[model samples]
Structure formats: structure tokens, C-alpha cells
Target: MSKANKESLSVGTKIEYRKDFKDIYLPKTMPVIIDVPKMKYVMISGEGDPNGEEFARVSEALFSLSYAVKMSYKSNEVPAGYYEYTVFPLEGIWDLVDKSKPATDKSNLKYTIMIRQPDFLTDELFDRFVKRTKKKKQNPYLEKLTFGEIAEGLCCQIMHVGSFDDEPESFARMEAFCEEEGYVRSDYTHREIYLSDPRKTEVTKLNTVLRFAVRRFR
Candidate 1:
């Protein structure tokens, strides 16, 4: 979209992914197949239990840089193709260090936490924002952040509403769906898009989008 067109658009227009791509974001309770196109994100990698302090610190660092970039555009120094938009929610791609192990053993999980960026953001722009954010405060994890595009291709996804510990119920349904549809779950671990803030939302009310990469069997 042109700058003039973006400017004239409503405040809601900034986040094209949220509005334009509901299949990937707002999936239904029943499993549905969708293709996730390539999209850019600011991501950081880490290991340990998700309920630990390290996970919290990693999340903080990502949000810090994301907010810095947003404020930069909103303030005096806006990057080219900058437009007003809502910040995307937190997302994670999780995997077990030992592929043989089940997901129930989460203590040794490896994860990449990320927040999506607008398509207009460039590598140079991302680096500048990183430096700008670092100068403001000292965060060792800042150096671990990487910006890149991920194309998850075809996936089966559903909206899971409940506590994190209760996700097994949803996973069971997804596994059954895969079996019924003749699709094999890929090695790629499940990806989660957090739609609710755990800090504020009740456990039973938590909203999470669960997705798994899959391939069809002949």
C-alpha cells in the first residue's frame, strides 16, 4: 500500500496480518488446514522450562526492542514505509532438545520467542532499532535477537482456550484430526500464538492458537 493510502486508512489498518489473515490468527475450535506465508519477525532463542525466570527475561527483551521500534516510528524518526499499527502478540515455536522425548517433559525445551514486524521493515532498520534500544539500557539478551522470514507452509491449527497445562486435551484432538485426515505431523514442533496475557487473563480464559506443520500422506 502507498504511504498516502496507509495514512488515510483507519488506525486498524496498521496490522494487516491481524485483519487480512484471520485463518492464521483466528482459527476455529475445530482443526482447519491453512498455509502460512512468509513473514518477518524479531526473534530470540533460549532454553529451559517456560515457567522459569530465564523465559520471563527473554520475553521482556523482545518486547523492549519491539516497543522501541514502534515508538521510533511514532516519534520524530520514522522509517520509510512506516505506518501506524498495533503491535503483534507474542508467539513461540517450541521443540524438545531430545527429539525422542515427548512434549510432556518441558523442563529441557528449546524455544524461539518472537513478535512479527511489518513487511516494510528492513534489515538495516532492524539493526538501527537494536542499537537504539541497547543505548537506552543494558540487556545482554539483546545480542541474541535475530530478524528473519519464516515460511511454515501447510499447517493444521485450532483455537485452544484454557490453561497451559490443559493443552494436552487440545493436542489429543489435533493428533486425532491428523490421523483422520491422513496427514503426518512434521518434525517441526508446534507453534503457539498467545492471544491472551497470562499476567492478566485467568488461566481458564487464556486464548492460544496452536499450530502444527504437517504433510499429506499418499
Candidate 2:
């Protein structure tokens, strides 16, 4: 780690992924194999291009509800395991609507967009935030958001520092790694974690973590 990266880490009261899960979040530009444990998230599902209006609506809804939960902890009541931490980067599980076709086909994509949650987040507490956010925003998309846990298990991952359109090159590295390691890509959607704000960052400078679920060849 660079001196700047190490200097930025605090002793405590941090939810930085780079500090905690360096292998998973701060992966090298080259592919690396890793294990992802089960984790909780606030998620919503949709189909078609991620650049479409529906995707925007869902993204807005997730952020709205997530902030609602944060504010609730700040003012009303902090949960049992509540701690000061950054809201997780937006992530997505992407696949093709037509299973037979390539998952990369942008026009027929299916995705479950999500933001990771703290361990203290409970179903009851999540419900309260949902109700609170709904009352404030009155967005129908809020109803689609749900809380759940997912175990991605073993996988190959890499940091793709370019436009989303360039992810195939990164995935190519992961694919080669899997093939040489005698692993088979699992029947799970490819996962991407956005580390840069697309609205502000240049496409070539976008930082994204790409992961593929995999298991040993059997």
C-alpha cells in the first residue's frame, strides 16, 4: 500500500472496504482469486440497459432508503452494532435475460442492484426505514427494495480501471485464471462494484471491481 493509502486508514470508526477487505475491494489490475463470505444488502431487481430510466429510478430509491436508515441511527435510535461508516458502494449482479445468449449483451441484461448493509441491520429496522422513506418520497420504486443476504463464495476478481464497456478485457484475465486453475464459472450473475461516480468521473477513469463466481472443476 502507498503511504497515502496507509495514512488515510484510521484506527477505528471506519467502514472503508480498502482497509478491511483489501483483496476483495482493492484488487490489483490483474485478476486475483478470492473468497467472498455471505453479506447483507439492500437490493432491487430490474431488466434492460443499466443506462435506462428504470435503472436510475432504482438507484435513487436504494440511496434514499439507505440514507433514511443512516439518519434514523443518527437521530432516533442507533442500532446495536451501529458505528460510523461509509455507505457501501453501489453493486450489481448482472446477467442476460436470455440465458443462452452472452451475458454481455447490453440490451437484454437483467440485474439486481444493491448496496451492502451493516451486520446490525435487522428486518424490523429495515421495515421502519422503508416506511419512513416511503412517507417522505412517495416513490413507488421504494416498494421494490428488499433486504437479504448473499454468499458469493469462491470467485475471481480484478480492478477494472476504465469504462464499463472495457470490462470484457478484465474479465478475459479472470477467465484465463479460472481455466488455468481448474475452476468452472458458477451459475451466478457477474458482480460489479462501482467505486467512482459516473456522473462526475470521466469514463476512462472510472474504477470498478469486477467479480465472477466460480468453483473447482468437478
Candidate 3:
């Protein structure tokens, strides 16, 4: 089982392959954790299904938008220091997008939308994200763009069950499982490729893929 798949089931959850995201820049592929300021998006955050409309909007942005993405090596954080977003061999990132309102109270109000780093964004990329947000006028935030280095190597990951609120318990279990198997965390940041939008999904059915970069200790 792959790191992501194995982790998903260990916590009693199911994860399906969305698709194979690839690019022509194969060997030069860079992973980045970004600091995207609260910016607006075309699809508004709602309840019951984040993947409902907002995802379509973003899908259009990443795969449909004519703009290119940015790439870098390190967390978007200032000074770039964190132990949670460094999972490699899978391209981990600490994405920070500032949303008008957080999906949950625990989310960083000033910073929202955390995803993988070293994106393939070009100059007009963020401009497009903003354009999408302009579709809604109720509340506004920016998607600030910052870059981080792309850590490399093999990784083990899992898709978590339940709400973002339930991450702690799953994390604990996953940690123990990895450790028992003789795998050690690289102190890389804990990362989640959020599939279900917290705003639009039920707390019980949320989908978050958690991944940690593991390497054999020398």
C-alpha cells in the first residue's frame, strides 16, 4: 500500500485516487509550501460540500486557468521554520491562503488555504485567484503567494477520517503506527491535501489526506 492509502485505512477511512496530476516539468518538479494571503475566490465557502462548487472553481484555476504557478523551496512562513510541512518524496507544503472567513474557528483567520509548495504558478496566477474571488462580494481576503524549498525522498501518508477537528487523534495513532514499524518522522511539517472543503462538508465526512516524510535514520 502507498503511504497515503495505508494511512487512510489505518484510521478507518477510505480515500480514492482523484487523478494523476502531472506536468511537462517532470525532473525539474519542485514542491513548495506557500504563504497565500487571504484572497478572494470565485466559489464561496459554504456548508455540506466544499467539493461542491469551490473545488470546481479552484480546479478551473489550477488546471484550467491560463496562468502558471510559482515554485520554491521552503515553507511560506517567515524564516520558514516548522516541523509539520516538510513531508518529501510526495512534495509537502504549508500553504497559507487568507480567506474572508475560516471554515472553522481553529483556522488561521489571517491566513487560509494551505497546500503543497513550489506550485507551477506564473505572474498572472494570483491575479486569477483574485478574479475568482471577485465573483463574491460579501467578504474579501487575499491569496498571498510565498514559496518554500521542495523536500525530496520517499514518504508515507494517510487520508484521515472525520473533521479537521478530529486530526489530533488520528495523528497520534498514525504516529505510533509509523514508529512501531521502525519509521521515523523527519520533523517535516504535518500536511493535509484537503479534499473536502470544511465549509461545505459535514464534520463527520470530511476528507483530509495526512502525510509525513519518513526516512531511515543514519
Candidates in order, TM-scores: namely 0.89, 0.89, 0.42
Model 1 TM-score is: 0.89
Instruction: Summarize candidate 3's per-residue lDDT along 1-218 as a digit string, tens digits.
Output: 34654333245322122422311112111231222223222211222333345433433333222122221122131111111122111112332244454434433322123333223333344455445544632222233233232443555555676866676676676667667766677754555565665568988887666655676553
Runs in model 3 lying further than 4 Å from the true structure: 1-17, 21-143, 147-149
Expressed as tens digits, the lDDT of each residue in 52-149 for candidate 1 is 98888788888998888776654455677667767788999988898787877878699999999877789998998889888986788888899999
- Which scores higher on TM-score, 1 or 3? 1
Residue by residue across 90-134, what tens digits does model 2's lDDT show? Answer: 999998899888756777999999998878899998998899899
lDDT of each: 0.84, 0.84, 0.40
Ranking by lDDT: 1, 2, 3
Stretches of model 2 off by over 4 angstroms after superposition: 1-12, 100-104
| Candidate 3 vs. true structure, TM-score | 0.42
Q: How are the candidates ranked when ordered by TM-score, highest leading? A: 1, 2, 3
Residue-level error in angstroms, candidate 3, position 109: 10
Model 1: residues with Cα > 4 Å off, grouped in runs: 1-12, 100-102
